[model samples]
Target: MKFKSLLAKPFAAYIYSKIQKEMMHAVADQEAILQNQIKTGCKTVFGRGHRLDDVHTYEEYKQAVPLRDYEQLKPYIEKIKQGKHNILWKGQPLYFAKTSGTTSGIKYIPISKDSVNNHIDTARNALLCYMAETGKHDFADGKMIFLSGSPTLERIGGIPTGRLSGIVNHHVPRYLRTNQLPSIETNCIEDWETKLDQIVAETIGQNMTLISGIPPWVQMYFDRLQAKGGKKIRELFPDFSVLVHGGVNFEPYRPSLMDSIGGAVDTIETYPASEGFIAFQDSREHEGLLLNTNSGIFFEFVPAEEVFDENPTRLSLKEVKTGVNYALILSSNAGLWAYNIGDTVKFVSTEPYRLVVTGRVKHFISAFGEHVIAEEVEQSLMSVAGAEGLRVTEFTVAPRIQVAEGLPHHEWFVEFEEAPQDLSSFSLQVDRQLRKRNIYYDDLLRGNILAPLKLRVVRKNGFIDYMKSVGKLGGQNKVPRLSNDRLIAEELMRFLQ
Candidate 1:
């Protein structure tokens, strides 16, 4: 083992033990966080406006502060942007994480001094937990590359602002700096294709051990490497052992990624957002991510079905039940209160609060009154593809409500790395699996209200081309799995094979 790996092993063990202890006392830690947030809120302008001073319990907090999305909270954020102090949190935010929004053009999410530590620490602990559990710390001996946005910042209201990943890039520890790949100048390139080429040139010959990024982008990198060197990634970088992925479901992309690597590696899934780092995969044996309850955030879950109601049922960590789908809501030290982050999740284990991200609240197909979520489609397609030993590059689903002669149906745009022998039969199996998982879809098909989903084969690099056209090619952007309308479907039709 390298000297760095030997030094990190004991530290990883200590951090893992601390994390295990925190998981054991998750409920108590959550309660303490909630109380602390409430106390801090009393001194903010938002708290005064919402009558937070009189709120003594969870029920009172709920009644005093209504759930708010980005649009609803924009007014207060605007004041903060104008250099107001104690508007949201105790003082001005340390940074604004700028992200593209669907309805709203651009969103500036605040990261306060108290909340930023959670983002950095949670990520470190996740890797440390893996090292402690598996005794595999040799990856630290070689280079580690996190494919992220540029570590560039501009001032907004005198506060540093940039992408969340970019902001975090500035805080990477001194020890890891020498081991990090793709020099700062290369990362600063705005265009993804240009940056991608630069990254390939810089790291292709290096001893890359750990690779991290969203799966699709990482897949793109792998393709570039293979094209350049004419060798599998495993052959090019024999020490490559761990892949850290987030932002989307990994199952659909796993077959293709594994094929490119030519072997197996430890993969870790993380639940991170501009608001906070919510969860991370803690064990290789576990099925779900271990919730970050001891962090500077308090979590709540509203039943998915009732999310649009005037007042939805909000359940705390102690009250959530396994297998029920719920929309994630959070109140954090960042001064976001009862904020709905638009993600739907299901608890797989309530004992230690392990949950799986189901889908986004707005990213679903309900055009035909049959609410089809991302989870159902991902599971159905992956199940069928895995059974057939086929490889899928990427895919998305959108409703097709108009037809010339027959009933309308869901249209699946699939890009295949290895096409199945019988495409029609594969589509049928996928539809069957989805029907079994979702009774509403089955009922719609039985009632003749909708036709079976049709698969449209897409040309290679179709999704990538579409994203590039829209100027959202990389850095935390992902193709939505499903949509209620045909906006994306119409645009995607141009790429059909």
Candidate 2:
């Protein structure tokens, strides 16, 4: 009834319809693009290297096209880097966004002119969703700050290319770009410390009213802001209205962020990845993040009932329904077709196509044969922190294999705002909760295959410092929360020692 009231307003229904219509157009366009590529791929396999990147027919593509990855696309990407417009697209690209995935190495993902157009469209849809929910569309009246990777467009090996953050800043409607202060200065790739300092300096007098980015780096920035002590955020930005975040779960890091903001600001969670813009916060309840099905992306779902494999069944947009957990697979205009990026999600319902992120398919710990997921770790930390009246600064779980000739056990490294009353008891409670949630862990417990869980109290910035030492402090890189027992045990030995 409440949702009906919210959707009944003429303005709300109009906006929603517009988004739906635009999304349909994107889907249609993407299908056409893929059809063309399939044709070109067919031609290439039949001894036609010169004719590649040209238009292809459906039959030509369907006959010979193979699933591609970053490695397979390397030579074509190099041609693009050489300023060869015809290699990847018919026109020159606006910029190349350097995206890193699953490793420390960087990827030069060319941002085609049409993809830039897609960014504008995506930005508009985000705004429209905001307006439909709150009935407010006046973004110009207030300042909005996007906490992005250093805005400096750094070169990979030799070519000067922007990261996704820098490319987005470079393409921001031209007007908003002028008023904004970039998190990174131009041509500076010195290091993280220098980069953070320059970013902090840029914020000194800016009246930024809205902020967006990964919550961890945003929290780090706010910590630095608090240390400065002279400028309170509320005083500096009186019109501050919202916080937008994406890329990871927010619950474990919420308390410190809430305290910094001083009050409840409008919160928006987005699912923007290198592949496509998947979803955004659509309602006040935070019940489900709405999918942007109109974007030139066709969605597929792999049910959680089975392990994802070479031949897992996929559900199309028409077939997905409510209350089923599924891994997401996407086909998009940017060249990924039915490619699985390994994020797991579940549909809250199908008609409106709302879904919630369940976890990462690849980011699980199977140490000592107990499969532990990121969602389990996040939920456990959030629940425990809330119940104990404790504010967690940052925490990570590392599964340890017993090296003393006994059963392996799980260990958690936690950093809190203050110490707890009973460290050992608190540790036991968290372990029990974790064991209850994870079926694999419960089985191990019953079999007496695992020892009791252990806890380690870490200093603030402990993980941050460790990441920095490994040269993976930020910028699309995240510390792994779960790993196989071998990797976890190795990491734990280093940290514990």
Candidate 3:
């Protein structure tokens, strides 16, 4: 038995048992965490201003701190950029993870020493939870490759700046880094096109037991391997047994990936954001992701149905009901207080606190009173494709505004790995499934508020080409699954044309 496995096995088992207990008593856990976060931040300017010192209970904390987004926090973040200390958190920040903005250029999210340690711990424990649930430790014995962003960080206000993946790269423990693929020189390459080529060259001959990355890029890596030598990935690396991916729903990519790998492998999904590492799939016996209740982040939820309200009611883990979509809000050791991350989730189970990501707050379309989300869109596509024997590669949907001549409708730009025999029928099938799922959409269709969901069969490699144009081709970056407006759709049309 390897030393790493020996250390990892017992650690994983303890976490697995602890998680089950924590989730069973989640209300107390959440309440204690909320108070602890407030107490910890009492020394910061934000805390003093919000009377964090007096906030002793979850209700009191809620009354003191108003929920905020990146825009609302921009002012404090700016002060921090000017070398401010004890602003949001209790100390000076050493790094800032640069994230793509929701509506604009860039966002600099502060990352402190305390939060970085929390990030590493939560990330490791997620995988450990899986190991504890299922006794599979063979993959840990050999090399592992994770497609991450370039580790060449730039300095912003004397603070290190780069993608969240880059931040995690620096902190991966010495034991694992020794067997990690892709040399430091290769990771430093800024351009993804050139970087991927280098990664393939470095990893193709390695005895890789595990591969980790966002699904599309991993597929791209597999594609390059096949194009180079017509052999399936399993043939090139026989030891490959695990593929861990996250950042997007996996169903759409499953068939393509399974085909590429040429066999069934253990797959794990994780939920890590620029804001914080959130959750991971814990067991093969169950499907939904286990929430990290003890991961230095206190989570709150607002019913997605109430997200647009001026004063939405905030609910803790104890109060959240299963099957209702709720927008995730967090207060973390990272110095964010009552921050809305904009992602929506529905609880699949409350006992072990397993949930499914529903969609983003900004990614939904509510025009014509029909609120359609990414989950609805993706599920509709998956159903139609499965029935029609088709494989879709990448897709995005946006509303086509009403004109003088006709009614507005949802337009889908889909790039397919296997195109349906009749494109028109496929589009209709997708439309039908969506209508079944979304009654508002169905009502609009019946009432003529929407003409029909439009579908355009995009050219091969169109999504990759579009992502390259935007300079976000790989590493935690993915094409926006849905947009409320025609900005992305129109741009994609222009680029593909």
- Which residue pairs clash within candidate 2? 23-294, 38-61, 39-61
lDDT of 2: 0.64
* TM-score against truth, every candidate: 0.99, 0.82, 0.97
| Candidate number achieving the greatest lDDT relative to the actual structure | 1
Best by TM-score: 1
How many pairs collide in each candidate, listed in order? 0, 3, 0
Q: Arrange candidates, best TM-score first.
A: 1, 3, 2
- When 1 and 2 are scored with lDDT, the better candidate is 1
Once superposed on the true structure, which residue ranges of model 3 sit more than 4 Å away at CA? 495-497
As for candidate 3, its clashing pairs are: none
Pairs clashing in candidate 1? none
Task: Write one digit per residue (lDDT tens) for candidate 1, span 176-272.
Answer: 9999988999988889999999999999999999999999999999999999989999999999999999999888888789989998888989988
| Residue 232 CA displacement from its true place in model 2, Å | 4.6
Which run of 10 residues does model 1 get worst, by summed lDDT? Answer: 414-423
RMSD of 2: 5.5
List the RMSD of every prediction in angstroms: 0.9, 5.5, 1.5
